[model samples]
Target: MRTRGFTRCGVIFGLSVVIVRLIGGSTGLVCYTAVESLDLGCLLRWDCLHASPNITYTVQTKTQGDPWQDVPWCVWISSRSCDVSHVFSDFELYNMIRLGVHLSPSSTVWIKPHKFDYSDFTFSPPSVSVSLKNDSISVKVQFPCATNRRCSHDACCPISKLIDPWTTVTVYNERNRSDNQSRTVWTQEVVSTVEFSGLSPGQNYCAVANFSFPTFSIAASPKSAPGCVETGSRWGMLPMYCVGLALSLLFLVLFLAGFLRKPRRDRTTADNPPKPLATVQDADSSAPPIFVDPCDIHVELVDDHSSIDSFHGFHKAPTSGAETKRSSQPTHFDHSRGVTVQHEVQDMTFESYN
Candidate 1:
């Protein structure tokens, strides 16, 4: 039992020595300040090792005759305590930081300024990125980090990563050099990115970011070096014009085809071979002749003794004298001896009516 007791005492002593050695050089109540000493322009910090990690700590401040304001610098509860390093004024009555454990919170502790012989502090600004959008411009502010803080293998204090304070931004038209007009906007420190509207299409713009606090103010690192962007339009009429042009070309092609082909179709119809006629009457000599009566016949008898009815109306073949029968006549006959031969004469053509 004595041996066990001795071993326990040795273990406890070793743990105490480790604790003292770890926090020996730390300032602001040891294991509180980021650096070893509380020199000029240094941060003052503290943390409760026994506090619950689930609870939150708020770093609030109340000036004379003013409501309490919550400064977001070192506001998270990773350290189980709050810090004040960014913004402060020498004229304020007191700055209170509160650690709330559920409904029952510890009393608000007033933080006094860490006084020093000299007071002027210098801070450099970070770079600002400018991006172009269809109708708006986006400006992103980035803060530079310390070499040792970012280079550390283990994350000793995560609170230092949140460094951006409240900022103000100014944007203006790049081409409006004569008028010298610009727009001003205030941005919260928590928001690293901000957008400005009322931008015209195809127009150039310039913007700059500025950081301001109650105690200090700083502009961008490259002063007066503004970022520029050119705006564009989302909707364009080129597609519509192209479609209309295509349609017009199609119509023109159709018109040309129809107009040029009409003549060929008409010529084909007009130049067609002629069809045969229905009747083909030709002159023929082998067919019988045709005739019709043109007049009526009339004749008058003279003092010749031959009977008028015996005179032939049309000519007939003359008979020989031997076959002629003798007729009574007022005798001027020239007859020969036994065969008396007589002469006869007749006319076939008629003259006009008298």
Candidate 2:
């Protein structure tokens, strides 16, 4: 019975040792580093080889010759990251800062502290946008510090006040990826707007930018996500020109047609003058019309007093039956005093007397 009990105890101890080794080897802190963000200020990040449901983490920080202090917002948190930007409120950018990590329920084990200065923080990549002009490409870069609330409130924020800042821009043609151009420009503004000319029209171009601040000892940020734009075609104005030309030609043709038609109309009017319209008579008028016979009528004028008196005193004698019958018919004649006289009978013609 004693031997059996010893064997059971040995086996249990061996199993316990094996379980402890597996947990310790598989679950341990991997890496820790400081990140400087444009929007969030400074942050501390860490990673574990394997995440355990039961393990919680604590982060602590200390400056030179200062006692270790637990991050107020990061104590006993399961998250592997925390914001320590507030720790830099004192504007001690040159001071040496150290971070320590503690795992709960395993208080005996502690990770080594990581030491760094505020200036050593890595910068996050900036945002970028691209636009196309007639034959050029324009790129605009926006840094994170421009929109950070903390930087706005704190005038001493290093990121907000950059020194000797510049951007490296690279332009790539989408059709030929190997065909690219690069330029570096120094800018003092929060947002950098740049124009790149001498590019092929009707081609798709992409731009990427990385920000650098040599004064702060911060390395260049990671390249921003690519922004793309297509330039205007070289013949983009062809349609407009064609439309304008067509309109001009149409106007010229209309003018010529009007000019030619006017001359033709004038020639026709000159060649064939319009005949005078016959005078129209109103048949409904109440006035009577005078009738005159111009062909069968004859007139005689008398200027001698003897002829005028003889005409007044003359009386025709009685004629034979046939002559009376002919004389009975009406005769159209005129007699004037002191004027010449002429008469005509049915069987005899009388000459005019002066």
lDDT: which candidate is best?
2
Residue 101 of model 2 has an lDDT of 39
lDDT at residue 86 of model 2 (Cα atoms): 64
Worst 10 residues of 2 by lDDT: 12-21
Shift of residue 121 alpha carbon in model 1, Å: 3.6
**How big is the positional error of residue 208 in model 1, measured in Å on the Cα after superposition?**
1.5
Instruction: Tell me the lDDT of model 1 at 243.
Output: 94
Clashes of each: 0, 5
Best by TM-score: 2
lDDT of model number 2: 0.59
Over 237-296, each residue of candidate 1 has an lDDT whose tens digit, in order, gives 467779999999999999999999999998998899679654434333343444322232
